[model samples]
Target: MILKYIVERNNKYKTIREVLKNEFKISSRLLTKLRSNKKVLLNGFSTYFDKEINFNDIVEVYLNYEEDNSNIVPNNIPLDIIYEDESFIVINKPAGIAIHPSCLHYDNSLSNGVKYYFDKIGLKKKIRPVNRLDKDTSGLVIFAKNEYIQECLVRQMNSALFYKEYMAIVNGILEQKSGVIDVSIARKENSIIERCVSNDGENAVTLYEVLKSFDNLSLLKCILKTGRTHQIRVHCKFIGHPIIGDTLYGTKSDIISRQALHAYKVKFIHPLYNNTVEFCAPLPDDFRKIIENEI
Candidate 1:
């Protein structure tokens, strides 16, 4: 992707570097990279940052680059594409598959699939998952097409404008219809993946509203004020109503094979458009069945 900047009259930018750093918000590392690769174009010709830019000067920064993604072996898995653009790609991930490859999920991971898709389309950009959900959790996931888009979206994380909402089912109905869980969460000692409520941990906040209730279960619409690892599951456990079938943080259940949590929705500013965009995934069959009392 080429970031085009037209120098306006009475612009504060004095040089190509200034336009890139100040106007485009280009990080120092990326600027250095562009400089080294001669990726900056001044009026359609490769130019150095030291060049003086005058009014009506067009500066274009090239962001499309082929990368080495050999670590992740590509798999021919189908992607549930939600939205796609030059800046980013949105995917609705299903439960049981991870976002990236690891020792346990080496080839079947979502990144592996994305790599295959990228190869087919001849897009050599790196696979960058902008947000995260657990392996058992299903929902909307975004993969940035380039570094600039990644930086923009990542900066919005944990902020109000980068809204995220999840649908969760808990073991019991809450006495209160809606409330906030503001607390600190820390990794449990001697465990690699477990998180617990602690005063010494990082701050995490969750806002929840009861969406529906049936047969000892309460479906909740949970909005995250802060994104922490296993935040909603941990907070629900902290409140003595852990998410149903969350074997790691709560008891496993027969109603659903995996944790009854789905990343229902996400809303954020599109870095390329400078406008708000939202994406939502319908409740998966397992979640819907439970809500309909099929279990």
Candidate 2:
């Protein structure tokens, strides 16, 4: 393992070991190992543990470990692959399926599902998801089959080169036909809850238009301008209309088990072919049924 850190102005006066443990959150044992192995260096020169650091000082620590093959596993899991080529794949993920395994969820995730599919096709490298959807939200998901394609698609996402369209069902009818929700959001607790219009938060934006209106339910087409966790749900709640069935930020309803949101369309430049590619997933049966009966 190679660890790199650049000293910032806030902690310029601390010693290298102090900075590593306090600022960078490195364990003291790890620092001692790096120092003992003489793998701790400043500006390419091996530095002592007590060396005083300054602003802009670059420190590197090299650790010994075998390469990671933990992510490479073969399991025969079902996946709805919409499109696939040499460099990339697009799949329609279903609700109740997580995108990746984390501490809370260790198996039965979309990442594992992708790995299983690749193994079925005899591909070795792990597929990397470009964007993520919440576990309960279903929609089109894109994955890069190789590192080169992964970097390209990641750059596109950071530059907002890709277009994403989502469909949502809110609790009430909007007074306006079309509008934008510009709010800042931040996490409130350790839970998945978030606060909108927060003073100390990052900017989040969502553009929406009403597609149809029922007595108390509204079908909405939403385009995300900035991708923030729980942006759509939080913003909808901020505007006095929360996503129907969103247990986290809205009044619970019987329309759906989870938040009524779906990533319907995605458009981007293909990584391997270098041409524009677009994919879409039709609304899930449950969503359509809710609309048909409510609206």
TM-score of each: 0.97, 0.74
Residue 142, model 1, lDDT: 96
Per-residue lDDT tens digits of candidate 1, residues 95-177? Answer: 99999898976898899999999989988878899999999999999999888998889989846779999999999879999
**What lDDT tens digits, residue by residue, belong to model 2 across residues 149-250?**
566677687667888899999988889989998888888756554555686888888999999998688999999888888888888899888888888788
Estimate every model's Cα lDDT from 0 to 1: 0.91, 0.79
Error of 2 at 122 (Å): 1.2
Best by TM-score: 1
- The local distance difference test score of model 2 is 0.79
Show pairs that collide, candidate 2: none
Worst 10 residues of 2 by lDDT: 63-72
**Prediction 2 TM-score vs. true:** 0.74
